[model samples]
Target: MYQFNFNFEEFLAEYWQKKPTIIKGGFKNFVDPISPDELAGLAMEDEVDSRYIAQHDDEWDVKHGPLTFDDVPEDHWSFIVQAANHWHEGAAQLITPFRQLPNWLMDDLMISYSTPGGGVGPHIDQYDVFITQGSGKRHWRVGPKREDYEEEFRHPALRQIKSFEPIIDDVLEPGDILYIPPGFPHDGYAIETSMSFSVGFRSPKKQELLSSFADHVIANEIGDVHYHNPDLPARQCSGAILDAERQGLENMLRSLLDHPQLMKDWMGEHLSNNRHELDLIAAEPQWENSEVREFLTQPEVLKRLNGLRAFYYPETPTVAYIHGERFTLPSECEQVIPLLCDHEEVTGEMLGEMIEHPAVIDFLTQLINQGYWYPAE
Candidate 1:
């Protein structure tokens, strides 16, 4: 387990989304979870989203992978693997410490391996990120959010700012963390061969939420009530959409959103949908509820699949959402929600007598058979 030396609460109150700051010795004596060679091998896989970025003579080049690393020059090149946590168990563990933040806002862990002098250039990102320095040293330059900052595309695939006068500039060694919020201009370059693990967070735009909610309303056949005003007042101007009539029309849509249960249903389903692939392997012989109950009584452990998004709203505790599907669990299985979503590993000691509940047993069996979780070997 990685030990964090700083206070997360203090960091959130002071720096989160407010400014960019460097937390030195964030992970004391931090050891990298994945190595460069292993990262390279993952980049060769077609399903993984990987990229190669290099700069030479002030010109930039970008390539989408499945890449053979042979053509990559010895220096001035970086290999970036997106959603590495989905594929690598070690990478998945990096997100455990950041659970202080809501998992709904949490994005995947992006691991980058850079050669000497390698970087993606100075640019601004729309999401917040906590970048942890891994094996070697990287020099980072971060500027405060600015309205006048101009972004230019260095390569056809890469859009970067012309430059920024960095307020926070330092050479980050292993175990150091740089926290940057959205729209801040920043850049980093490797001083030596290095790896950086970035824990990113994203918030959906208003447009996206409206669009998703609209889709949910349409799918469920919600708000079928049409406008029929029984007491119609005579309006001189027919072309004018009366304020009262407009308010009524607006209330039609608002009514659907006003219901706590309906909104919760939509929130649970939309938020639990995984944006990245999960590492799932179904059981060879699907186990029955009896078998799962028996296994839970043993001294073994079951682990949640990497990158699977599972969530439950506190208001509706009995309803658990996993990968866009809703499960209305029995109140007897209430304890199972945290076990299923909060924990990466569920041990017999943790489950205790709760596993014996028929509802809980059946739920676990369903999860195991579907490959959302499995016995730890």
Candidate 2:
């Protein structure tokens, strides 16, 4: 299943970011993560968010629903469901290979099924996503890019759909993939029954960027420079802060962003931190004096949780951050970081004679205590 084909990796390395490239027959032996019936069942459930849009001739009607297979009108229009990443483990498995991408960069998987003539119309996304064509055919119309987009008020809920004139139009077959970079306007219409797994990546908007920046301003004393107060009348009731105050505030803000550590910390938190659990364990380190060589060298195993992300943060110095919690390890333990980043099961024997390293033993103990990675008891 992990066979990396020459062409696939080549496409990723070369044309992934530069241009749009379609890979035909990428998922060999590609058993679907979820069957069409299973997905249809998910659509029927009340807790799941699902919607369908139909186009009869030129008229487009969209409706939100707890849609079942029966509610669908035999053909013609697109059905979209969101947050499959949160609900269906099977749907989520489609994205398992890309875990090499940090959770910060990787967003979520959204699988959509389109019947004949079904499409969401020409639309543009601000974030990068890979649309993996599954099961049937979908015709895609993609433009190089036209960012000066005009959006009109359609529904108060969704942001207005973008109008695009496609430069490239082609029908994608099963096991084909379409990579659409941010700002590219494209639309996909199903020629027959089709399923597409959209692997999306998160990008921060201006407001989110500003919020994190503001947080960095207050958390660290990067913005603590005092504002100069010129001598003024005691009864001054100026609504705004004076020139010196403004300059000081501007300088502080600049200093906040200018702080070398600001972007680094923000990136670490943004990328390494999971949207889910990151519980920090409070247990004290236990292997400092104990010669646990036997314990480490024995048939020991490290268990990996489903959503765990174990990354070594160089900035945090002697700490390995896993699932957003900081686990401090000894300085000599740096080599052990890769072992954790492997994100799969590893035994003491596979860890080899390096188990003699006190630092490695200590690191394993801390990991076990944190439950970020646990011993296979």
Candidate 3:
């Protein structure tokens, strides 16, 4: 377990999404959970979204991977793997401490291996990130939040920005952490071969939320009430939609969202669905409920799949949204949903007590068979 040596509440109040700050020795005597070689292997997987950015002749280039080891240049290159937490258990542990943030907002653990002179160039991210140094050193520069920075593209694939006056210009060593809020221009280059674990918290854009909610409403056959004018007032101009008419139209849409149950359902389902793929391997031969119960009797650990987002709203205690699906949990097992949602590890003993209830046992069996939770190897 990694010890996060900063006061989270203080950080949230003082710096989160407000400014960029460096926390020196955030993880004392830090040891990298995943190595460069291991990260390279994951990048070679077809399912994994991996890319390398290289610079030559003052021009940058990018290549999407399933790349060979030979494809990675010795210097002036950086390899980045998105959602490494999903596939690598060790890498997943790095995100555990950041769980202090809301689970729904937590995105993924993006691991990167950079060679000397390696960097993606100065750019702004739309999401907040905590970049933790794992090994070696990196010179990081972060500029104050600015809206007018123009993008200067070195490569078609890389969206970099013109250089800005840096508010933070420092070299980070092992255990150091850099907290950067959204829209802050920042850049980092490895002084030596180094590893960085970035835990990102992304907020949904208004358009994205509206789009997703619309899809949910359509699929569920809700929010289909048509606009009606029971009392039609004669208008001076037929072409003009009256102010009352416009307000009514807006209210009609707002009313749908105002419905508490409807909003909760959409919020649970939509937020629970992660954009990235989870590392899931379904049980080869599906286990029966009896087999599931039998397995749970032992003191073995059952781990939730890494990067699997689960959420339960306090308003609807019995319902849980796990990976885009809602499970109306049994009343007897209401407490179980929070355990599953909030924690990475769930021991068999934890569920063993709840297994006496058939509904609970069946739910556990379904979860295990579906590969949401698996016995720890």
Candidate 4:
């Protein structure tokens, strides 16, 4: 287990989304959960999203992967694999300590391995990330938050920024963590063969939200009411939209919020949707209800599939959303909803409680059959 030492409330109040800071020895005696060779193996898989970046002098090159070990050079290159938690259990466990934040804000565990002098160029990210040094050492430089900066694209796949003055620069050893908020310019170069894990948090952009909400509205046949003004005064300027007309348009758009249930349901599904492909395999000859009950009765543990997004809304506490699907929790199972949302592993005792509730048992059986949760021996 990783040991963390920072005060959660203090960190959130003082530093989160405001600035960049380092927590030295955040995980004491931290042993890397995955090795460089293991990471390389993952990059070789076609379904995984990986990238190889190399820099020579001032010129940089990038190669999208499903790349084998032979394709990667010995040095001056970095291999990045996205959604490592989807494929690696150890990587998924890394998110346990970060549950202090809302589960809906969590993204994925991205792991990168770099050779000496290898680094992705300085760039700004729109989401918060906590980078934990896994093995070996990396030198990180983080600049202040800025919205205005010239972006440089040396290679087709790489988008970086020109040099900027750094406010935080230091060498990070294994177990060190660097928390960088959105809009900060930052860069990291491996001093040696090193592995680092980044746990990211999502912040949906306005345009993205608008686009998604529009799609939802159209798909659900919502907001179909046509505009009608019964008390219309004769307009002098027909082409120009009057203040009342503009306010009417605004009210028409804002009408979506009037249906709080629809909005809540849409937000729950949208937020719980996974951004990356999941590593899930449907159960072969799907388990029967009896078999599921038998397994639940045993001491075997139940583990949630990695990269599966699950959340419950405060407005409708009994309704849980998972991967764009909604499940109504029975009164008996409501108490355990947090366990299903926040935990990776559910113990036998928890399962025991859940199994007693027939609705919960049925739900678990359905999830297990669909491959969202599996029995862990």
Identify the leading candidate in terms of TM-score: 3
| lDDT string, candidate 1, 1-377, tens digits | 77689999999999999999999999999999998889999999988899999999789988898878877788999989999999998888888999889888988999999999999999899999999999999999999788888878779888788888899999999999999999999999999999999999998889988999999999999887899889789978989998889998898878887898888889889999887777777877999999998888899999988888899977667789998999977776677787778878898789788877888888888999999998988
The superposed Cα distance between candidate 4 and the true structure at residue 210, in angstroms, equals 1.6
Q: Is candidate 2 or candidate 4 better by TM-score?
A: 4
Question: In lDDT terms, how accurate is model 3?
Answer: 0.89
- 217 in model 3: Cα distance from truth in Å? 1.0
RMSD of 1: 1.6
* All-Cα superposition RMSD per candidate: 1.6, 5.5, 1.5, 1.8
- The whole-model C-alpha lDDT of candidate 2 against the native structure comes to 0.67
Best of the two (2, 3) by lDDT: 3
What's the C-alpha lDDT at position 281 in model 1?
76
Q: List the global CA lDDT of all models.
A: 0.89, 0.67, 0.89, 0.86
Candidate 1 residue-pair clash tally: 0
For residues 219-319, write the lDDT of model 4, one tens digit per residue: 99998999889988986788998998899989998888788889888888889898898988888888877777778788788888988998886545568
lDDT of 3 by residue, 69-139 (tens): 67556799898999999998888888889888998999888988999999999999999999999898999
Question: Where does the lowest 10-residue lDDT sum fall in candidate 4?
Answer: 347-356
Give the CA lDDT, 0 to 100, for residue 118 in model 2.
84
Location of the lowest summed lDDT over 10 successive residues in candidate 3: 347-356
Point out the higher-scoring one by lDDT: 2 or 4. Answer: 4
Clash pairs, model 2 backbone = 77-118
Alpha carbon lDDT at 246, candidate 1: 94
Q: Sorted by lDDT, highest first, which candidate order results? A: 1, 3, 4, 2
